[model samples]
Target chain A: MLGRGEIAIVGAAETTQLGAIPGMSQIMLHADAALNAMADAGLKPSDIDGVACVGPMMPQQIAHYLGITPKWVDGTGVGGCSFMLHVRHAAAAIHAGYANTILITHGESGKSRINATPRPPEPESLNGQFEAPFGPFGPPTLFPIPVLRYMKTHGVTHEDLATVAVVQREWAGKNPRAMFRDPITVDDVLNSRMIAYPFRILQCCLVTDGGGALILTKSDRAKDFPTRPVYILGTGESVETNMVSQMADFTSSRAFRVAGPTAIEAAGIDRKDVDHLMIYDAFAHLPLYGLEDLGFCKPGEAAGFIREGNTRPGGKLPLNTNGGGLSYTHTGMYGMFALQESVRQMRGTAPAQVPGAKISVCHGVGGMFSASGTIVFSNERP
Target chain B: MLAPGRAKPKPTPETKHFWDGCKQGKLLLQRCGDTGKAYFPPRPFSPYTGTRNVSVFEASGRATLHSYVIHHRPVPGFTPPYAIAVVELEEGPRMMTNIVECEQTPEALQLDMRLEIAFTPMDEEITLPLFRPAKGGR
Candidate 1:
């Protein structure tokens, strides 16, 4: 078992300009975020001894771009939540004395497609054989495959789904960096153009061009950094099925149920101890799944919890305070941004900061609920 | 004319049996020879027990609509508002497919509706097995 608070995030940052960047290529976005994070921590790239990142960009590519020769490297690209898993791996590596300082970067030209490598699995791959042939356009169509079954089982309504976007947009209003800051309502969400059945354009995540990075090191050295260190209390990562049709249950994610409890238990905290939450909202339904799977609310109760304004601004729990992928910038791999938001909230510097928030849980989903990573963060050392 | 942008399956050594069976208008499923557990998207080895002793068998092709989406986006070979669905085969595995021979509307694509397999030959090599609403004949 990993020791609690053994690793600390010494630095965290996103690309200087998020949303749409026509200038920076994908790798430059990764470099830009890396340098910015190094700057935030008052450390040069030379100080870093380890590197990690998602692919189609390799860890060595990120290390070379920033002029660092790391002793350890990680290219564990599972999906959007790969960065959370990176933090977990980085923590384990540090605890095992693999490397001292590790930098994990994420950059995707999801919208601009600038120098972006097309990463389709081989035609003979599992997805190509079983899923791609169905002509499911993309996440809009593919991710929502289980929605009808979930809604039918849970009694979650279109209005209830619409309310998720509405509530998150309310949080976005306070954020200048948020792409869409204007207030929206359930009516506005329902009235939006349909992308797929039961999913409006407003309900889907934004396809923006951006990147973010995080730097991790032992907690002992974290206090020496210029920026306030947010302790990595615990982490858990898991995967269920790459194919959405094969999800163990349509109503809940098997990965989420496993990763969330493991991290919370590792952190040695009860669900009530969490002061702020960031369950990745790549789609409106995800937060609902995240809430119930994480045990923040009972099954079938998350929609009502959001409708009651519990997760809205100034409610009992402030969720997706950075507006999430729904209104915040989602650069395809959105886990890094969620991690950055959790750090900002713990640091008491979030634009929509929650007052005296000590413990925050950031949960993420990758590839249509195929994988999950849960990381518990605390401003106070354990 | 071949439909532009419609992705076709590339059969592999392990999955060739499934595609070949589809060409013969049979929905073939693999079962663990040891445990007799049936599985889909064929594999050389049984997912259960990690046993290579697996047997292929023709299924009844009868299924129930487990879940689906009425996709409005225009993809190649498909018009707006098509039902991309997941159907649970009576033998016990769920697979992604298109619900065909019915109006592509939410009101029509009811969950738990009975469906039967229908093979559409994309080419000489690939015959995609789709699901259509079952008639009164069980």
Candidate 2:
């Protein structure tokens, strides 16, 4: 798989301000993060030969805007996890001599709706024909469709789901940049207003305005960068179904089952080697599913594993130390923020850094468990 | 006004029969002639084999609740709260539908409850095949 650690992330940074960036348009958020990442590595846009971003035809838009003439470009917008796929594709392209330095950027004016184009329902499309007639407002309604089935089959209680958010907020409480830093209890989560059945408002991710960017290059030249290189040990990306209703299984993610193992195997590491982790918490139920699907716990055991204080700070596995999408700022597509946390943890620069954490596994979800991408990072040169 | 302001499905060449069947009070599913697998949201070819040799047939319109969410937000035509459900058809294909003539509450809407299709015409151009509690079943 292109040899482990062949590609290294030399530069990584988010926009100057994250929470409410009404001042920046969607495209400008991308540019702001790109410029910051470039400055972090002591490089200019002229040094980058490859560019990638979310959505179709966006690579050309971002590359041209940054005044870069890229030889390799990728616009693999599967969903929120599209940035994870971009990192995987960029690494392969750099190794294949397609480009020297590759840049991946993510920006969404989710809260401000600045120059944001809301997708109109297509009556002629498959979703419009079958699923849309039932009245799903968006991710809040659509993503939770399978949770009742999951809870029934797994014997998971509502309190188990609330624990996922409660623990992540514990991590968020340590970060000054987190959107919600106050300590929250499981009762507090349950008492919050219900947006959907079995899911309180605290369980859902925040819609914020932010962006993040990353710069990847060959590990052989990693020493030349100003920032410490976070080596890309392995990456895997896969999609199960575009329609959430068509998912093969409601309790487990097929995409997560495929991507997580593929990445861990590609890195040739066991579960114990991963000291820190970031599972995209678009909702509280996601972390429960991710933990099981990624082989951290057996089927139906993740809820209890999380409830037992295993993933909290000073626990065996510190997960979502940046508060994750639950407490951290989620700008629609949260994969970039997850990757940024992983890079920070590996470099020992995270706001709530895991002590001596060498390997960090970052797993992300797109849409309603529609797609998944798992990336394994290590500070140690493999 | 039958379901005013609701987004209606625009049938494509391959999916026309399914919509047409709903108008005539029938639930049609596409089955691959080569593999004998019945599928939903009709497509021309089999998803398993990619063969266009497929046939359309009337389904029994019987399904069991696979999963659902009670959305509490107001949408275009739906009320403040409604059950958006996915039902596992007896033929093995699952589809997203709504449960009608029932209270939209967890106490009332039980998982794995038997359901039967009740086609409601949204407009002259489209008819939605919704489901309700099956008669003479659990």
Candidate 3:
């Protein structure tokens, strides 16, 4: 229960150029986002005392390159959801007086794939021994294992899958920063080249090079910052299983069920209290799972729920208002962008602003349901 | 020679026997004597009882299709539009594998269809256990 109004995100910013920038290295994206966030906060490197980041590099290296010595740092790398966990941990640290002005950063060249190094899992390890030999290449290939099963069990059709992609592009059309802004239809998705079964090019997220950073400090000290503080209402993090096959249920992520409710409960609010929502849409099926597992809809009902247009811009929920990873900048780890949207919606500065939106629940997944982190943000303080 | 990027499972302390069973043209699963919980993807100890005492037992090598995808993307050692699938073994655990010896299409690849194991030799030391439609399945 971390939402006692103890810590807040004072500043947040994404890299200036999100699409293909061949000149920028992975570390450069990180540094760029860090500088942009500091500039957004009207603070210098000297004002930061803590750091958190995820990539091939170390936090100390980022701190050194930024010319700041962090009194506290965290490299909680569980894929994309790593930054959400960092924000939670930083909040706890800020409350405990471990450090002040904590900075969390994320940068990845998911398309460029520059400077990304994943240590090969031990052949004896769980995935290496059993799962890897099957040749599920990447997220595009592997993630479908459970999603396909989910579609079958839920009786979700290809039309339903395409509808998810179609509606997301509607949101992307409003975002000048979104990469693919051409208005697309459900048939456009159903007819696209199949990267994996049931996943066309449109149903998947974009591969771009991007970075983002957020600054957290004590809530009492937040008024001094140039930007309005987006108060942290609650945060929750959990892991389901390392392998997709081992997940307790293919239709829903146990991790999401655990983390999502935990955050809403910690904030002491009901699901309806969430005025704006940002569920990590690494693929179309994710939001469906997030909606069901987060208890917005019952199991197997999210497909029809989205079909009825409840999550569209004018709809009740306004999910993935940033166009989502499906159309927005998804540099492999998409949680950072999702978190940024929640911050923007709370600040009333979103490109597609939800009118009078106060509370936002942003959920993210790490691997193929390998891990999850939920964050609840509010414009109001407790 | 196999394709350039096939990930050959390097057997470890807990998994050596499972690979060994595949090499010997048999399917293996680990069972705990303490809690009677059967598990796949061998481990050093039983997940149910947490006991170090476990033994390998032969499986029927028969399974039913739990789920599948006709992966249109290219994978290492595989051509596009190949079927990658998960099968629920008779022993009651699912394994990720490739379905072979049949056309990779929705008409041919049905869920919950009965299937049997077929081993492909990746190398002299490693053999992959692939599945194909059982005689009665279309």
Candidate 4:
């Protein structure tokens, strides 16, 4: 849990534009985000001693461009949740006296430039050869399979999945940082061109080119910073089977099942006490599975939960207030945005701030539900 | 002219048997000798006990359609308006397959619909396993 020792987010920063920008390289975007984040925390580049990054366009290149040598560097390539996992690692590193302050950074130009079109390494063994031959290619096709299965088992409809996009778009309309701010309807989603079975164009996330960064430090050190501090109360991470074929349940994510309880317990608070939620929304169905695995809803009930408008604004649970990856800019690194949103909410700086939000939860799912990371945040001390 | 290195389906040794079995109209699953658990996408080691020496067995042709989705768009190699389903075999393993020979609509896809295995050969090297409504349809 996060409360055992003091780890607070003293600063957070993001690039001005999230969509396509042809002028900037990946490293430049990351450097710009890091500078903005450092300014937000009222700190200097020299203050950073540790670095953690997700699957950026070029990690070492970014480090070189920043010119801040970190004593500890973690480049965990588990996809979006990698940033949340980095936060957990940063907290431990700060606690262990390995690094006093850590900067977690991510940047991508996936839309603008196709960097390093290196050939994929040949599968080392026989089993890898079998599955790779099918041309699913990206996450869009891979993730929908389980969601389809979930729909079949629970009698969930495309309309049910469309509701997620519609609600998130509503939030995006309020968020200036979101890529798509226009309001959308269920009919719009249903009528959109189909990419995979049951998943319309609206159900997929955007391929944005953007950057984001977060600064983490010891709790006591955070008090000395210029801004209000948001503490990290608890954190959990788990990995399921890598291959989609080997997953135990297609509809339910094992990472959430394993990490959710550990995170809440570590925070030392009842699940109901958490005031805000930030579940990853790479695909619209992700948050549904996350909520069910985190015990917010029972299995096979998340569809009904969304249909009743519980996750929309003014509803009991206001999810993805920053528009999430669905309507917001995914940048292929949504976990960073989730962490940044929670930190802002806890600091009372969110555009759609929850009234007296003292506790919050942020979750990230990486690599075809192969990995899950959960973190609990609170204003209260243990 | 095209380059020599391009996208092509290649089978690994572990999955080769399963593909071969599909061509032969047999659904093969691995069963752990120690735990007596049936597993899909056969693995050399057991997921339950992490024990080695897992044995392969021919699964009963019978299965129950656990869940499915009606894909309106055509996939890379698949045709338009196909039903992708996850069927739970009688041996207690679930596999991804397509449902055919039925109306591709939600109302027709009832949970726990009894289904039997059907195979569609894509090319000389690959054969995909699909399912269709059993004789006495549910």
- Lowest summed lDDT across 10 adjacent residues in model 1 chain A is found at A117-126
Listed per prediction, chain B TM-scores read 0.94, 0.95, 0.92, 0.87
Model 3 lDDT tens row, B58-115: 9998998887667787777788788778888988888989888888887888888899
Encode model 2's per-residue lDDT on A39-75: one tens digit a residue.
9999999999999998733888998899999999998
lDDT of each: 0.92, 0.91, 0.87, 0.78
Candidate 2, which segments miss by more than 4 Å at Cα? none
- Give the alpha carbon lDDT tens digit for every residue of A66-86 in model 4: 877788888877878988888
DockQ of each: 0.88, 0.86, 0.70, 0.32
Q: Which fraction of the native contacts appears in each prediction?
A: 0.92, 0.83, 0.70, 0.31
Q: What C-alpha lDDT, on a 0 to 100 scale, does residue A35 get in candidate 2? A: 96
* TM-score, every prediction: 0.98, 0.99, 0.97, 0.88
Residue pairs in candidate 2 whose N, alpha carbon or C atoms collide under 3 angstroms: none
Off by over 4 Å in 1: B1-4
Judge candidate 2 at residue A190 and give its lDDT: 93
Steric clash pairs (candidate 3) = none
Worst 10 residues of 4 chain B by lDDT: B1-10
**Candidates sorted by DockQ, best first:** 1, 2, 3, 4
Candidate 1 per-residue lDDT, tens place, B74-135, comes to 88888888888999999999999998888999888889999999988888889888988999
Candidate 3 Cα outliers beyond 4 Å, as residue runs: A1-3, A118-124, B1-5
